[model samples]
Target: MAGGGGITPIESGIIEYAIFIVLLPMLAFPIILFLGHIFNGNQTWVKSA
Candidate 1:
């Protein structure tokens, strides 16, 4: 039988959490801006009239 290490799960979970935390904003900003442009009709480069 094979046994699992104790720290591996925690380490992987931490790594995943860190990635999610870091990427959430990185992904969200662009998506929010895109949606704002699409739904709110705001220009990306220019102010709206």
Candidate 2:
């Protein structure tokens, strides 16, 4: 409600949508790490000059 900018949760369903939006990144994060590990396979960081 603090950041809703006067929009009510019942009117916009912002609370539900906010949970989904927040969880999306959280869910994607694990999948991203898994995919990266599979593709990169413990690759080490490169050094720069």
Candidate 3:
């Protein structure tokens, strides 16, 4: 990629976008999991005797 007054390395650009692509799921997973539990009404699968 080209920048003002300089050239940006292609590898660096790819890695920068890759960081967001990889990071988004990593950050969202925990948030989604917690939200699911809260919305799930605290139910468990196993039947209690």
Give the candidate number with the greatest lDDT: 1
Off by over 4 Å in 3: 1-12, 42-49
Number of the candidate with higher TM-score, 1 or 3: 3
C-alpha lDDT (0 to 100) for residue 39 of candidate 2: 65
Encode model 1's per-residue lDDT on 1-49: one tens digit a residue.
7776656777878887787888899999999998776867546667867
* lDDT measured at residue 14 in model 3 versus the true structure, 0 to 100: 87
lDDT-based ranking, best first? 1, 3, 2
Worst window of 10 by summed lDDT in candidate 3? 40-49
Model 2 scores a TM of 0.51
lDDT of 1: 0.79
- For residue 21, what is the lDDT in candidate 2? 81
The model with the greater lDDT, 1 or 3, is 1
**Candidate 1 wrong stretches, greater than 4 Å:** 1-8, 41-49
Best-performing candidate as measured by TM-score:
2
Winner on TM-score between 2 and 3 is 2
Q: What would the TM-scores of all predictions be?
A: 0.49, 0.51, 0.50
